[model samples]
Structure formats: structure tokens, C-alpha cells
Target: MKLPKKIKRYCPYCKKHTEHKISLVSTGGKRSALKHGSIERAKKRGRGRGLGNKGKWGSKPAVTKWKRKTKSTKKTNILYTCQECKKSHGQKKGKRTGKVQIENKEKKK
Candidate 1:
């Protein structure tokens, strides 16, 4: 989806509405020390003592899928940085999309 490079919105730090620069909030780089990462490694090696099921209230599956799966599409979110105060506030969740673009006049052909 395409979004304006800048937006106008209420800035709590500025005490009024102001122009804000828009940017996509990234999911960030991978962390080897992630909680699930270590737990998965342990489960694979079969020391599965403490890492129980992380899902639903219904009856547990008869056969568990070791290869966890997730939705391909992720909900897009954005950050709006107030130009005056330089403070940022997270905008409401955006549409589900694989990518988002900041519409830039300079980059437009």
C-alpha cells in the first residue's frame, strides 16, 4: 500500500496537531536468544520438560506438527514522528499487507 511520506496528526508532546513524518515500524532483526528459539531447540533435542503447548483452549491435538506455521500476511503498523516535538506515536494498525511504501515526490518518475 502507498502512504504519504508525511501526515498531519495530533501530537501530545507539541500540545496540538502538527505535521508528522511517517515511517514503517519494522519487525526487527532476528535474535538467536529469542524465548521461542531456545525452547524450540530444547524440544527438538527431546528435553521437553517445561515448554508446554502455547495455544488454544480446546482439546489438544493427537499429533503435533513440529514445523510451526503462521500466516504469510502481517498487519502493517506505522510510526508518526511529530516534526515540532520530534516525538513519535504509533498510529493505529494498518491494513494487512506484505509491504507498504512511503510516497515520495522526489523518487517518483
Candidate 2:
């Protein structure tokens, strides 16, 4: 779906409506190993070498997986980046589609 590159929206920080840059918010990558790597290693060592405790995930029966299906439509995350303050905001479930195509829609007379 095509969308306006710049949109007039409420800016809480600026306390007024301003033109914000339209962009797709990407799903961030996983955290680096340095931060929580040590903690996870300590946990594994304390627990046994094998899968000490298979949580709810492993407890489920894998044979029942085929019952559920994936959704046809996916909600795209639209990010509104304020040009003035340079702050970004996320719109939850903005538009549902399998694919996203960003483009400015010109005003028609």
C-alpha cells in the first residue's frame, strides 16, 4: 500500500502537529552476548548438562502443531519520525497487509 512520505500528526514533545517522516520500523536484532551471556552460562552450569527443565514450550506436543495456521495478513509497523524534534513513534497495527510499499500520494483536485 502506498502512503504519504510525510504526514501531519500530533507531536507530543513539540506540543503541536507537525510533518513527520514516514518510515518502517525494523525489528531490532537480538542483544549482544556480552551483556547476558555470563548469566545464561552460569544458569546452565548450575542446572545439569542436559535440558534441566523443559519449560512450557517443550511440554507441548509437537504433533499438534498442524492444527494452527499462520495469519494471511500481517500488521505493518509504521514509524512517524518528527522532523523537528527527530523523535520517532510507533503505530501499532497501523495497516494490515502481506507486503508494504511506501510512496507519497499526491493530492487530487
Candidate 3:
């Protein structure tokens, strides 16, 4: 399905509705590297005995057939900055805090 070019989303940091730029995230170089190298090795090793499934009864899922580990194909809206605070809140999924401010009550003797 064709996706929208821009979407109005609520930014928690901004605490209000903000315009988010929507674009398909291209697969990074790291994914290509893993697909071309390590993934191939894992698939080759996983097929033989001693790795697993030597005498197992259950059938393995077809999704596991792909040698390469697939990343999220869904499109996501990433916020570049906060609209209300006018701060650069990058698209990271963790709380970011600054150093605590301290006040000197008395001078050291």
C-alpha cells in the first residue's frame, strides 16, 4: 500500500502534535554485510546434525529457511527535533538526562 508523505503524530518530548517526516528506511550496509557473510555461515552450519534437529519430532517453521536475518520492513516516522521545546531530540528509544545542577550553600574553610 502507498503510504502518506507526511503524518501528524504526537511527540512525547514536545507534549503536542508535531509534523513528522515519513520515509522508507533503506536497509543499511551492516545488514548487507550480515546477509552476505555471517548469515550464510549460520544456515550452512544449522542444517547438519549436532547443531540441532538431529532426531527432533516437531517440524521447523518455514520462516527460518531464509539464511539472512531480516530487519523491520515497516515504515516509521522519525522525529528530528521537538516542536514545543525546540530541542534536538533524536530518534532514540531511551530517556536522556542532563547533569544535575548543584548550588553551593557555603564556602569551604
Best by TM-score: 1
How well is each residue in 1-109 modelled by candidate 1, as lDDT tens digits? 7789987789988889898999888755656744664654655665534556534222343244435557667777798999998999985666788668888743333
CA displacement after TM-score superposition, residue 53 of candidate 2 (Å): 26
lDDT of 2: 0.71
Clash counts per candidate, in order, are 0, 0, 0
Clashing pairs in 2: none
- lDDT scores of the candidates, listed in order: 0.71, 0.71, 0.44
- Show the lowest summed lDDT stretch of 10 residues, model 2: 52-61
What's every prediction's RMSD, in angstroms?
8.3, 6.8, 16.0
The residue-by-residue lDDT of candidate 2 on 1-109, one tens digit each, is: 7777888899888999998998987656555633654444544555333564533234342445645767877678889999999998888666778778777675554
Q: lDDT score, residue 52, model 1? A: 65
Q: List model 3 lDDT by residue over 1-109, tens digit each.
A: 3334444566777778885444433324455534644544555656433555533222443445545666534433233444455554434442223222223233344
Candidate 3 runs further than 4 Å off: 32-109
RMSD in angstroms, candidate 1? 8.3
